[model samples]
Target: MSKKVIYGIFDDEEILLNSVKEVRSNGIVIKEVYSPFPIHGLDHVLGLKRTRLAIAAFIYGAIGCVTAIWLTYYIMILDWPMNIGGKPSFAYYLSMPAFVPVIFEMTVLFSAHLMVITYLFKCKLFPGQKSSSPDPRTTDDRFLIEIESDDEKKISSILNKTGVTEINVKEIS
Candidate 1:
């Protein structure tokens, strides 16, 4: 049997919320939601869990910090021990100001890059991956809801109840 997904298109936030409510009330499961802009309280309406990006970012930042400290200490103390202007080679305590820039840059670099990679991986958006978005216009001025089901009658009923502006169906091969 072919897997089917019902896509609903909307132009307004209120109508989107109402449509979600109606579809959910009918015991239909929403596969995904796409929106052009952030809609207030829409995540709550869809019962979506909050993203853990902040936590991941913190962990990545910590990794960056450790890497920076290790690299700086190894280079300054062991590899190339250079004393500039009578300053101690391992003057980490006194030369913290100089190291701050490196640490900050590494932290930002690691957090930003790692967070993006993790987010993309978690969202199943790997390189050369194709997503099944029915309407490209949903990325601009429309909202799209994808519901997984093969019951056309139930899908049509739900769409009618939710006042969906446009509807389409796609089969996953």
Candidate 2:
């Protein structure tokens, strides 16, 4: 089934932000918003939930830390025990200082790489993927508010009062 969407275009970020708050206050649901650059406080105005990517990154880093510890201990202490700098061959704690750098690096590397990959997948973004922006101009200097509604007149009436520079409505299949 196809759905109808109203695209409210604005030339200024301030107006866009205020419009979002006002429109939502009028009991309208905004599907999404697009902009040229980051607009501080827009998320709060739009009532968007905070992202939990930081939690995912922390978990990934922990996995990397554990893997690094296991790899270093097995190679240096168990698999090929070597006495370095008078430290006991089998004493992991005795040479833990030497392993700190490796552990930290591994944790950072794992978290950064895995978080990026996960973000890409979450956004369905990759090389050669088709863009979904309703207006090409939004990438440069314009902002867009996408509202899905069945009553065109109702949505239009709301946006018209919100100082939108332009309004475009279309049906998506």
Candidate 3:
């Protein structure tokens, strides 16, 4: 069965929380929420699990570190083997100071780029993908609750009962 999202917009945080409670108490499933800024306790209100994006970023950063180390070592010590002055060419410990900048850069580069890519992939937000957002205003100054439902009448009733300021329906086809 295809699912669609019905959204309710609210201005007050208290009203938003109350609406969420009311809808959930009625056994309706909320798909997601959008807010202009992070709302205190909203994640708990929505029963959302913590994201693992940081963990993924850490792993990607570690991969970048290893890659940078291997590449630098291979190029500086093995491939060219240039001895500057009396310093040893393959001095891994002595050359560590020079490697610090490259290592740091690689770590940041990999973590940032990979995290963005992973987040987009996880949310199915690829290029040309059309996802339903209730209203553009919701991104600016309103709080939005997006719920999955098929019964329009029931959804409208819930929104009315919850004191929603505005509402919109979007089919995710």
Candidate 4:
């Protein structure tokens, strides 16, 4: 099923930000806003909830830390015990300082790479995926706002006052 949506195109971020606030204050629901770059505080004005990517990063880092510890312990203490620098290979604690760099690197590696993968999956963005933006200009110098509403004239009037460069109406599935 397809529904009618109003697209308000703006040239400036400040105008777009103020327009969003004004639209929401007037009880108009905005579906999405597309921009070329991140606009600070737009999320707050849009009333979006905080993301959980930080928690995911911490968990991924923990897994990497544990894996590094296990790998070092198994290789140095269990698999092949080698006496180096007068330190006994059988005791993990005796040579734990040498594994600190490996542990830190592994934690950082997992946190960085896994967080990127998690973000890509969450956004459904992958190789060969077509763009979902309503206007190609939004990826350039324009900002586009998507609002699903049956009343077109009222929205168009309000958006016109908010300084939209152009307004377009379309049916979206």
Clashes of each: 0, 0, 0, 0
State the weakest 10-residue window (summed lDDT) of model 1: 88-97
lDDT of 3 at 152: 68
User: TM-score rank, highest first?
Assistant: 4, 2, 1, 3
Give the per-residue lDDT digits (tens) of candidate 2, residues 9-51.
Answer: 9999999998998889989899999999999999899988888
- lDDT tens digits, residues 96-170, model 1? 677888988998899999999999888899879975667789778999998888786788777777778888887
lDDT of 2 at 14: 94
Error of 4 at 94 (Å): 1.1
Q: Over the stretch 1-173, how does candidate 3's per-residue lDDT look in tens digits?
A: 56677888998788898888888888888888888788888888788889999999999999998988988888888788787786778767767788889989998999899999999999899889975665677668898898888886787788888899988877887
After superposing candidate 2, which stretches have Cα over 4 Å from the reference? 1-3, 85-88
Q: Between the candidate structures 2 and 4, which one is better when assessed by lDDT?
A: 4
TM-score of 3: 0.78
Q: Model 4: number of clashes? A: 0
* Candidate 3 Cα outliers beyond 4 Å, as residue runs: 1-6, 150-158, 167-173
Which pairs of residues collide in model 4? none
Please give, for residues 17-129, the per-residue lDDT of candidate 4 as tens digits: 99999999999999999999999999999999999999999999999999999999999999998988787786889789999999999999999999999999999999999
Cα lDDT of model 3 overall?
Answer: 0.85
RMSD of each: 2.6, 1.9, 3.3, 1.8
Worst 10 residues of 2 by lDDT: 82-91
